[model samples]
Target: MEQNKTLVTEFVLTGLTDLPGLQVPLFLVFLVIYLTTLVGNLGLIFLIWKDPHLHIPMYLFLGSLAFVDACSSTSVSPKMLMNFLSMNHLISLIECISQFYIFASSANTECFLLMVMAYDRYVAICNPLLYPVVMSNVFCTQLLGVSYIIGFLHPMMHVGLLFKLTFCKSNVIHYFYCEILQLFKISCTDPRVNMLLIFIFSVFIQSFTFMSIILSYSYVFFAILKKKSAKGRSKAFSTCSAHLLSVFLFYGTLFLMYVLPGSGPCENQDKMYSLFYTIIIPLLSLFIHSLRNKEVIGALRRIMKINSS
Candidate 1:
């Protein structure tokens, strides 16, 4: 009915925490994380752009990853920070859905990007001879294009499905942002079809990307084991070490959240983990790839020297 539509035009976001005392402190903490995410990810992209030495497939992918991370953080963090200070956590239905779509698309896109990076690493380490020819500029551009396309397309399904359901059961979303599951939970209409479709698509996307990355890494490790020189093996290991760690964190958290059975956490715990991937993961990517990376460090020093002069 028109009454129902008007009744639920706006949804209340539960936000990260409900305690009044925790609000300001959480806001400050997330503010720092948000600011750091912007500075760090943007800084990495800048470093890659400025440093001629990093103009390769690996660095290009890393730069793109940085760009995606900046987008992911921006999509979630500003509103979260604002809600922390304000008593009203009201978000219009359209705004909420749009926010989820942006974040979800970015997330799915990052998964594809990670998969591409795995292939890039495998080519570099497992098939070094063909790496340059195969990962040429055109190919890299296409790979990025495919990743972004799939990422954007996959989430539109859930967004469309969202419009079909009526949310008269409750306008209060139990989690932060307009997560697909939370929206389904509050719908008065039977959400079984929506849930089933979402589950199927989610499984396919996560499994396809995660499995491919795993397979690529497996081959990379196998090839490393065959190296005659210990130094060569060590070098190969070092090359993919940052990437492996990033894959573990990103995929591990996601699997726990969506793929596993009977693994649901309480509302607060869910919020905490959701916060981790949305904001914390971006910051982690910068640290894992750049802060401890010798090449990135060297690149930074060079850029600093140039700027200082």
Candidate 2:
């Protein structure tokens, strides 16, 4: 164990490229995407905070999701951006572990947050009269608090098991970041425990969250259909659509990346799928929520009009 400790002080990340030509282009592209992600998410958070009309449980959950997306992107993008410009993509052991923890926590938090949002929608649509009482500020705060607590705690288990493993083989990680799966691939120690934990945790988390979302939306759909007024049904559908889109994007990519067992070798495809959720999803979510959301757009316009005056 002592010998293993001295063997790996740092790790080399291959970082999404082997070609010199692709490095600059990838950097420029991701830099733009990263900047957009920051602006969109942070802007949404600010809008939610400043708009009195948005001071509801729904927007509060959206704000939390925005915060998680921004933090998740920050955890990976800056290092990835730097690696694109440098020939040697080296990361210290401590930094690698920290990145994995932050990324995993943010992701786990998002899953829970989305489930909360779906429930919020379910209550609002299916039990409109009781929505105000059930989704009160206290309840929302408790849900957010629980989401964050579970999110951070779940990843710690994986990281704890990971730290015990000794890496005596190669230090070169195949993927861009210090992903738990990729890290497992290079460990000289028995990774069976880590793999089992990942499978168990992933299945538990994904299944619970996914089922909750599905059930919530199912009730929401029936409620909407029961609405006598066409306009009321339309409004309800519009409101639910944004959350549905986000769920589809997040869970769809996640399922493809983690849940589905691969029939054959597809490491590169896995990397791309991971990148989509980690990097691309944050950027996309801002538009998904803001563009279709009448309240957010109205808030933006009001803010813009005030600035013009």
Best by lDDT: 2
Clashing pairs in 1: none
149: Cα error in model 2, Å: 0.7
- Cα lDDT for residue 135, candidate 1: 99
RMSD in Å for model 2: 1.7
List residue ranges in candidate 1 displaced over 4 A. Answer: 1-6
Give per-model CA RMSD: 1.8, 1.7
**lDDT (tens digit, per residue) of candidate 1 on 1-309:** 656454488898888768899999988998999899899989999899999999998899899999889998988888888898888899998898889899888999999999999999999988899999999999999999999999999889988988898777689987767777788778888898987887787788889998999999999999999999999888778868878899889887777666762366576666666778898999999898778778889999999899899
Task: List the global CA lDDT of all models.
Answer: 0.86, 0.90
RMSD of 1: 1.8
lDDT of 2 by residue, 1-309 (tens): 555455676899998879988999999999999999999899999999998999999999999999999999999999999999987789988899999999999999999999999999999988989989999999999999999999999999998998898887889998899988888888988899888878878888999998999999999999999999999999889888878888999988787766663422688888888898899999888888776888999999998999999
Clashes of each: 0, 0
Q: Which candidate leads the pack in TM-score?
A: 2
